[model samples]
Target: MKRTIPPLLTAAALAAGCGTVSTSASSGGGEDAVTVESCGRDVTVDGVPERVVSMHPSLTELLVQLGVGDRVVAQAQDALGEPSPELAAEVDAITSISADVPPTREDLLAQSPDFVISGTEYEFSAEQGFAGYEDLEKAGAPAYVATAGCIDRRSEGAVADTFTDLENLGRIFGVEDRASELVTQAEQDLAEIEEIIGDDDPVRAVQVYVEGGKLYAIGGAVEIDVLRLGGGENLFAGDSRFDDFFAAEVNPEVVVDLQPDAFVFAVNDAAHEEQTRAYLEQTLADTPAVRNGLLVAVDNTYVQPGTLSAITGARIVAEALHG
Candidate 1:
């Protein structure tokens, strides 16, 4: 069953003056000479981007992390609006592309952005009817897609590949130093976690993202990497992407067959936490995870692919499994 959860409202306030971006050059070289890959295409950014637009929240967060939030002139519709207290102030100056739609070409062109950043190809596809990078080329604006979410699988090496993309972004944004530091920190964090958990005994676990009473199983290399990093085994070893499974497909009898020792619930709001917990308790009462009370709740944001997966995500899972 697939349940649609309402869009989450962020309590964070938008940063003041996000809408009045200035084209004046900074003290240093503008992002004009910078070049970044967008949807597998190389885009040359002439100078430091004076006017920028971001299509995804994850990409927006990445820009901020790189210390270039002030360069952003506009943002996508759902991408704007504060989602958390930490991000509230940054979102203030941004203009919404539309009530609920991604930024249109006219909206983007009006902003006069030198470059645009997106976390995935879906952002471009959903916003522009154009097939690929051609639309961005025609618009005279460079676009970049975070490579973390573009992997063929979510395996350990794939996870490392995603991390490499973060480094690539840092290089493009003139923050190569910071990006390297972050990658080093993330690697150390993962190593420390693995050391603490040790390879002695791995726990069998399954990630269950519940929204609107529907249960979806996450597969692929990325999901598996997360489970392994937490020192757990993924119950579903399929080749399909993350997909939904109905009650019948889940098969009550399969619970015993898979024998997951724990269940991870990904949710957006606190209200649904208890509701999902109760539903899972009732539905899988006979399962080992339920009997042992190993149900855990995680932020939906972290579970989604992006830079946070290497930073906040690793910490969240480490604390859950070890602390």
Candidate 2:
């Protein structure tokens, strides 16, 4: 793939200085360290971390993409969505230190990790009994949160945020080349999907998450930005109800009134996808999306904040919307 940044992503980088991530080499305490902007904070990692704890599968997958999977000493093995086939074996091999998704402070500290990375800052929530950033810092472990999951960046996140995280990880792990390669591949993949969708009238869709018959619309997050790359416009992207939130419970009547052109839903597996499709078909049979068979199912992981999987999600959306 051609190593290039997408033109649209330039704006993503310039949106806010808080979301921007950069790295600089520093000699602190007679040790080589890399200081990078993460979650609107400056975190310096002294030397490459040989023992790292990944708080979520997304972060774990990203570390693997950066060619530092071997450094991951412990990870949370949650079945949030399907794991990437290419890296499933390697990811599964990583030890799970706790049954909890975000291991407690005690368990995490016991591992004596030098570095800890999480998809969301919530993983470091002291209120939730998990290891906070301060706790990690005091324990000689620097914690880094992905830009997409930053409290200030989550609502306005985009595909470029993932690139920022990738580059930052590369710098931290002394694998800048590998990170660039992955970013280039993602950019090329998105470009190809966009080219295929060129000149097509964008579909008006709503990304919905269903569980126990409750409906939640995904909006004001990176998924909305990713959907646009696939030639779809979210009906609720500008709604105040979804402002600054990933998903919000929406009334079925509201969806029926909008009569969306398509329904882009997230699924954990094929069965989940089929169940969502069936529910849409039966509950909102009058909607154009249901009648026209324009329901698109994307893996849940692909729809999360700033993930390389968004490329795959956008492709799935592009093919369904334009093909």
For model 2, the superposed segments whose C-alpha errors exceed 4 Å read 1-30, 97-100
Q: Could you give candidate 1's per-residue lDDT for residues 1-323 as a string of tens digits?
A: 12222222110011111121112221223535665553345567665667788765545666676688888777674422224447656755566564334555556667766677754444455223322344555555666655644322222223565565676667667788887776787788778777767654667777665545655554533445666677667777653332321111244455556678887655555766788798779877888888998887765444444544434554556566666
TM-score of each: 0.73, 0.87
How many backbone collisions does model 2 have?
0
For model 2, how does the per-residue alpha-carbon lDDT over 1-323 read when each residue is reduced to its tens digit?
22122211212222333232232212243267888888767788888999999876666778887888999999863455666778788887888865334577898999999999876666666655677777788788888877877766776778778998888888889999998999899888988998879899999998887766777777766777778888998898678875545567778889999999999887766877788888899888889999999999887767665479878888889999997
TM-score top scorer:
2
Cα misplacement distance, residue 205 of candidate 1 (Å): 0.7
